[model samples]
Target: MVRKLVSVAITCCFVGSVVAEADIKNLLEMDLDEILKVNVATGTSNAISEAPSIVSVITQEDIKAMGATTLAEAVEQIPGLHVSNSVNRLTSLFGIRGIRNNNTPNVLVLIDGVNIAEITALSVPYAFRYPVNFIKRIELIRGPGSAVYGADAFSGVINIITQSPSDLAGTSAGVNVGSFEYSEAWINSQFSVDDLSVALSITRQRKGNDSERVTQYGVLQRDGEFDNIHVNATYHELTFNGWYWRSEQEMGSGAGIIGNDIDRDISETISAQLRWVTDIDKFTRFETDASYTNHKLDGLFQLFPEGTWPVGDDGNLFLPPLLL
Candidate 1:
């Protein structure tokens, strides 16, 4: 139940898989015990597990074993974190170490070492729905990380790692359906041309507010649909990833009013990242990273239900007739 858990999830499932370009053989054989011994900082060589903060890492196997559907649900299993829904949009919201708020502010989210948090809101839009099908692992830091990760890593950091080619293992697809009219479908494929390897995933999901207890205005209509595409490629020392996601989420309550159910919030986001790594010597490694992201959101709000506003020539609200 970490604040910005959705963003962390979206950072994982939104962008999807990762490419283990350099040192694939070594990375493929490393186990959790070896991972725990890995050093993050190249300068001071600090161990992530025993550093100035408390840290936890959750593997993909762990999530699958838990039978958790969403990334928020998976992260909530950790202690000292919580996740809940926002009032109007019903987006994911939670807190870290008792620092609770409605929106994400103090937490920093990263996917494969790339920053994907929306600049203005400091979190992904609520419209960005995340599924757990594509995640590889999650890293949580419960204390200060500002000195290493910059200003946004105040309360904690949720670093999501994605699946590699060895993990995906060619192509696979699945579908999920259950109560509340919820359904999800996804496909993952991987291929290699000579030394260039590529992995891709596409997902579509929808959920209906069928539960009488899901919203305050149970009589009003509420539902949402999401589509996402992700691509990861690698050629020796160079690696790249790109993602496209779109969502149309219904607002169960009109601007948080007690009993008003209104319209929808729609959004689209495109993100890309590139990285390079090389061994400088027997004891040194050189690495560089770059990323780019663009996103847009629109709230189609309705103050009242249908027929509340006068119809116009275009079927939208007009200036109304002049009073005599």
Candidate 2:
């Protein structure tokens, strides 16, 4: 697969007449052992481990090197993990260590110490999903953490910490435009007033693709748009700190040639939390956190008879004669 990726990358550059950016020295200087040596679980109240349990941390620097735009893309590089991008933009199935269970939520995902797993279904939804630009670090701890954190932490725990006031103390903003007329813009700024710290951010993204032919049985839709606005507040101290965030997204779909229907989905999330940490003694400390998130989804579809419309939307039709 690596060879195939390399070949594709080479062919892309050759056909497009574009220059690729890479650090040959950094590639040669990379050490697998050293890269995996970083400790992560110690910072939290979770159980301790004698030996690393297939753990790894992808730093912001590492995320930049990969030039990936999605969390799934960044996580696919982890050993023993497979990320499957399904038809639904709000669905992603991941497997780890040969545990390929489709109907179970074996993997747990936490953002800023809060569990973001979907409760209505068994897996995580990609609609209100977190983005990479807002990420600070991704910590993966393989094996079961259910005993310490609770259910859904079976396969492992993926903790993604978004950029905080401390991480983005200065000012940073950029715009990117590329193929398919795809475009994106983002801003990360911080402010300080006395002991209180605050940060604000906004992002927008859109793209159009016509790579796949539309069909009734197959995935007839292949385009999407996303926009998000975020804010962070913090009261920095040795004993306590707190923060909160909210975002919204919309995904568009194209109808097959048979029908003139347009399907689109809209979703939003509002999350808030409070956390307090206090030291009981020299070597021990107690921590507590509470949070809540409200998420919703709305989709519009079409209705047609059997075989009448090769590619028709899913609209319930009952008591047709009376209702019509």
Report the lDDT tens digits of candidate 1 across residue range 150-241. Answer: 77777878776666665678899999997879899999998999998888888899988765664333343458999888888899998888
Alpha-carbon RMSD of each model: 9.2, 14.3
- Model 2, residue 91: distance off in Å is 2.4
Candidate 1 shows a clash count of 4
lDDT of 2 at 75: 83
Give me the runs in candidate 1 sitting further than 4 Å from their true place.
1-30, 33-48, 214-222, 255-262, 304-324
Point out the worst 10-residue segment of candidate 2 by lDDT.
1-10
Which candidate's lDDT is highest?
1
Report the number of clashing residue pairs per model: 4, 1
TM-score of each: 0.78, 0.70
In terms of TM-score, the best-performing candidate is 1
Clash list (residue pairs), candidate 1: 1-76, 1-81, 1-82, 1-83
Per-residue C-alpha lDDT of model 2 across residues 211-277, encoded as one tens digit per residue: 4643344443445666666666677532122223232332323222224344455544455556655
Report clash pairs, candidate 2. 90-126
